[model samples]
Target: MIRHTVGRLVSTVVIALTLALFALPMLWLAAAPFDASPAITASLPQFTLDNFAAILDNPYALGSIRNSLIQGGGAAVLVVVLAALAAYALSRVRVPGRDLLLYLLLLLSSVVTGTAAMVPIFELATRLNLIDTHLGVILVVSGGLLPAAIFILKDFMDETPTSYEESARVFGASPLQILRDIVIPLVRPGLATIAVWALASVWGGFLFQFILLRDPDKAPGSVILYTLYTEGGSPKLDLISTFSLLYSLPVVLMYLFVSQRYGFRFHGGIKR
Candidate 1:
């Protein structure tokens, strides 16, 4: 009885510590923006909007959110559209070495991340006259993300029954029509997942956007946030903490909205 009690107490302590480790940063993030003298440690906010006001006065700060929206949203849409098409095709067609090809692509994408291949990517972008362009960044980001997106979506597409397609075919629906009308609605949860994943990836991406875009004005929120540092490279926490909250809010809201609407639970396969 003593051993069991001790074990339970130890486990509880460990769990509490783990939770505190994760929660402290979040607590600071939640509180520090409103704190007049924001510090690394968590404390009660002074309930001031001065941090927000200072951030707003910085031209790059608020504008970076718009840039992020454009880049993130564009990249996400491209990824979803292309991934959905590729995933559906792979799911339906019996191509030789298909699974191998998919795995190979995924492996290469994972192995050759943007940072590792930045030199070649930059060279290629320059050659294509894509330097300093949002389109260039969007395309580059989309290319890196495609394999994984397709891989995730393929499972969802594969699980969807062909009965719906067959029924649409009986009604003389074309492949495009069948895909648009039937398959899309059925696999919407998967699409939402991909969209959210892609958006978050693109939104948080700093290196790719920083390396690709020369003009600070065109920089995304991630890149702009990097400028929130002192000459000695210590973060200007008062400004950054507020910016971080603003930067994170959109993605969090998006996630909550999608979770409420679609619920990420897999129904295994669609029933007739």
Candidate 2:
């Protein structure tokens, strides 16, 4: 009992610190736009809404926010649908190179940084006349997300017993019908998690947007934030920070809201 208590204590402390570490930056970012006094500028917390006002008033910032939602939401939906089918196959089928394919998927998914894929992705997009197009950006971002989404979805699907599929088959359910009615409902939580993460990735991403899009109207918030970095003096620090904070708010809100609704759901049917 004493040993178990000590282990639990250690785990609790680690989890608390990990959450704090992640929350600190976002907390600081949320606070910065509200700090107004000069001495406070040195280091104090005087609150004002000017920063937020300035950001919302900026046409570029507003446009970028809208673009981010449309592009990210659409792309994530498309990717999740495609990934669900791919993951379903991976969970159910056995091909000649199946193990090898999965192994390569795990390896590629582990390669989180996408800097190396940019050149070829760009070349292909340009050749296909997809550059500066929202669809193009969506395609590449979805590709990057594919491996991770597959891994997550496949794990959830694998946890499901063969009996479920067998029972469905015995009932004369078509493969498509089984998938739509049974497997999908069973793994909806995993799908939600994948969709959330994918949306965040596309919304927060800058490299692809910066490279693939030349038009300000075509780019997302992160790319617009990059524009602020280049502007140096257009909106002022407080305004820029406020706009960024605003830009981030929707993503943060969605995460918090969805995580609340599906936090445990996302963990269901999976072994720790």
Candidate 3:
């Protein structure tokens, strides 16, 4: 009884420490935005709404957020739609070397990341007249994300019972119709997972957007956030902290909504 009590006490202390370590940064982020003279360390905030108003006054700040939503939303939609169709096809169609192809694509995508392949990607975008365009960023980010999205989604598609699809087919449902009515509903959790994943990726994406978009108006939050630093390489903590809070809200809200809806259990489909 003594040993068990000590062990439980130790575990509780360790867990508390871990939670504090994580919570402190969030507490600081929450506090510093309101602090008139925010610092690196968390402290009692001075309490002002002026930080937000100051952010609004910056010509590119709010516009950059809107641009981020456009780029992230577009990329996420493209990734989810394409990944679903590709994963469903690969799941249903018994093509030789299909698994190998999937593995190869996954491997290549991992090995040749956007950072590593940026030169060629930029060249391609330029030749295609895609530079300085939101579509270019969406297309590039979506392409980079597709293999992993497809790989993750394929397992969900595979776990789905084909009997439902067959039944829908017997009832005169076309392929697309059956997919729409049956397969999609079963794999919704996976789709939600992919949507969130894709959105997060594009939301934090800086390199492609920075390199492709020369227009200040087209810059996303990530790029704009980078500019919040002083010319001396020190950060403007007041602005950075405030912007960080605003920058993080959308993704957090999205994750919450999706979690409340489809959840992250990743069950793939209804069990028999």
Candidate 4:
């Protein structure tokens, strides 16, 4: 009885400590944005909106948020559309070595990351006149995310009963029509998952956007956040905190909205 009690006590303490470790940073992030003179540690805020005002005055701060929205939203749309199409095709069609090909693509994409292939990517982008372009960054991000998106979506596709498609076919529905009218509705949760995943991936991404876009005006929040530092290489915690709060809000709001709408429970498409 004593051993069991001790084990439970120890587990409770460990869990509390783990929660505190994660919670402290979030607490600071929420509090420090409003602090008149923010610090590394979380404390009661001096309670001023001046930090936000200062962010507005910075030339690149708000624009960077817009740029981030454009890149993240664009890449997300492109990835979801392409991934849905490819996943559906691979699910319905019995092409030789199709599973092998999907696995190979997923493996290659994981192995040859943007950072690893940045040199070749840069060269290709330069040759294609894609340097310093938002479209370039969006395309590159979408390409990198597509394989995994397809892999995930394929499972949802596989789980969907083909009876609906067969019924649509009897009505003389084309493959595209069946996909649009029948399959898509059933697999919407998977689509939502992919959209959220893709957006999150691009939202936090820094390396590709930083490398591809040279214009400060076109830089995303991730890239601009990196520049929030003093000449002596110290971080500008005040601006960083303020901008980080603003930068984080969009994705957080999106996640909340999606979660409320769909409820992420899934065993293939959506748990029923």
> Best candidate, TM-score-wise?
4
Off by over 4 Å in 3: none
Please tell me which model should have the higher TM-score, number 2 or number 3. 3
> Between 1 and 4, whose TM-score is larger?
4
Pick the winner on lDDT between candidates 2 and 4. 4
State the lDDT of candidate 4 residue by residue for 31-64, as single tens digits.
Answer: 9989988888656889999889989999999999
TM-score of each: 0.95, 0.83, 0.95, 0.96
Report lDDT (Cα) of residue 141, candidate 3.
Answer: 94
lDDT at position 108, candidate 4? 98
Clash-forming residue pairs, model 3: none
Q: Model 1, residue 169: what's the lDDT?
A: 96
Q: In lDDT terms, how accurate is model 1? A: 0.92
Worst 10 residues of 1 by lDDT: 263-272
Instruction: Compute the lDDT for candidate 4.
Output: 0.91
| Error at 203, model 2, angstroms | 1.6
Model 2 CA lDDT for position 174: 88
